[model samples]
Target: MERTVYEEETYVGLVVRESKISVNSSLEQDDNQLDFDLKIIAENTGDMLIIASYSNNTMGENEAVNESVDISNLFKANIAFRYFNGMVFSCSVYDFYDQMPLEAKIEFTMTKRISSSVTNKDKWEMFCVFLDETRSTWSDAGMVTTSYSLDQVSCYSEHLTSFSVLMKVTTDNVSVENSETLSLMSTVCV
Candidate 1:
């Protein structure tokens, strides 16, 4: 039994420009019926369109997210990001009812701008957290408390310089409806 050929794991460089940024349900449905999507594959020239992934979907029918709505009249929660040079990383969602429950806390922070020539090489920094809550206004209530936490950073051959990586993503107790929409999407590769 001698016939073996194994060669897997290939990433050949040079991805010039690939762009896609979205916030849906027709761009927040005139201020409600919310839906959001943000995708900007790559742009080697760099000015922050390097995000290859970002998704948050909560459209309709899939209700079962316990009851804890009323995120303080639900308005004023924007988490923005645009780095690479154009520089624009944002944050908001200030204590949304303290994140719900008796000691709830859902705070999504942002500020990630790392381009010291790929933080020194062999690079991979990924942070993805997406949770679409529902209950359709508590019709059958029993689920909405969403939770998320994931962080991965690796930059081998160290010699890093350019930095600004403080991307905190947190979530707890998410029962949304009343024009439900809590969205965020981020997938970047530079």
Candidate 2:
């Protein structure tokens, strides 16, 4: 699965929607600070992942991070596949109602669907992104290969019990700057 985006950004509120997350940084301005735009999209073959970010200050906030993970052991730790990098960012709006910082939150959601098979073999595949934080953009860092193991097929009585996908989330704000790594695996048998 893949996500397609255009340069135009719209106001979608503080929470990110399902399937796609949009961040509108162009509306904010700072005379002494450098300006930047942040966007993120996550996709999968049989499921969906959602991530949302918010700010802790009244003036709002901006973040940038890079994440990467490896899960090739499912098909025998083959270097040809099972590893990827993705970019993530979140923003929080300033609320004048009470005058205290709103705690930052990151949300992730996964929805299930039927698995896809190739040539009568069930294969799990995911297309992810890698970010160049220096420029705040996505790039194709490598190619991914997929295969099924004979032992993996024979073990669960010819049924695959679990499948995994890689995800990375990062934040580069002064208050909190760090990278988040995750390996998302589905235990649903297929």
Candidate 3:
């Protein structure tokens, strides 16, 4: 019983490339369908393809997970265990050399950058917080599902680990290349 192959590192830009492909970690469709999809195929590195999917539905009673490292069922709600009401890291960035398909989101924010006389900026809003390093505390990540199009931004995670997207910046001259928040991270060569 030896099947050990786990690697994940995908960062596009600034030259850090390594593409490996391997799929089928209990590839679910039905039969309880507690999906934990991980698709990391960044091979050849042309045509620019970026896709990340980690899902769940929750159903646990026996307890024994290790399908290439299963993060249980994340979190939907927890009584003792059996969690999974949300978890989706959907990212899509297809730039066939500026063919256009770049608006994929992965924002982790601490929010700070507003100085143009501070005009309120229509009450800025952007939230997706969850950082409970054991007990440091920072709640509210019960996002069952969130979707958006015109480039793509689908954040559906009831719980994971290390999360931040809490932005409430009052618009005013916020420059830094539009506040400079662009992310695309991946790690999976397992």
Candidate 4:
């Protein structure tokens, strides 16, 4: 999620929260190289989030967004979890010809905030979770979090659904970026 990157960035943009009535940025066919790499975080939950992007070549088109949602009252929130973040993803990709969502590989990275106590590696207990549509429940995304780097934890994603990168916390105070402030344009790398 830093400015420095070493991969071929096929599609990169503002990660937004996906809902029933969806509006997302579509990755297009292009030959030019976009030279920007980005990283963002969840405001309230204190979870620093990063995105690892890819191009779904077999797919005619795919829809996704990195969105953050903050609630004023956790007592009334729908998700019954001890830890949850605004870093949610809507991963509904359509077949170029069939209009169905296909399973694909995705990943997330979290950078350690140097000055913040919450980001302390010793005190943090974090995990990634995805929402199950039929049961309306949040379950573990079954992804692996590896601290291969000294300052980041990247998790692997394997399916199409809504995803959240969460962290355990003892306080209710948190901040999230407003949806209106985000731009959906994507960045590609050479």
Summarize candidate 4's per-residue lDDT along 26-111 as a digit string, tens digits.
22213311111222111222222222232322212111111222322232221212322223444443333334443455555534
lDDT by candidate, in order shown? 0.21, 0.24, 0.30, 0.36
What TM-score does structure 3 among the candidates reach?
Answer: 0.21
Q: Order the candidates by lDDT, highest first.
A: 4, 3, 2, 1
Steric collisions counted per model: 11, 3, 8, 11
Per-residue CA lDDT of model 1 for 37-128, tens digit only, reads 22322222222211111112232112212232222222323311212121111111111122321111122222223344332322222222
**Model 2, 119: alpha-carbon shift in Å?**
7.6
Ranking by TM-score: 4, 3, 2, 1
Model 4 TM-score?
A: 0.39
| Model 2 stretches astray by more than 4 angstroms | 1-101, 105-107, 112-190
Local accuracy of candidate 3 as per-residue lDDT tens digits, 1-190: 1123222332111111123222222212222122222233333344443333333313231221112121223321111211122222233434446545433223321212322332444333333445445655434446422532222223434333433232233334444443332211112322
Better of 3 and 4 by TM-score: 4
The C-alpha stretches of model 4 lying farther than 4 A from their native spots are 1-85, 110-122, 148-152, 170-190
**True lDDT of residue 18, candidate 2:** 26
lDDT of 2: 0.24
Off by over 4 Å in 3: 1-78, 85-94, 98-102, 105-190
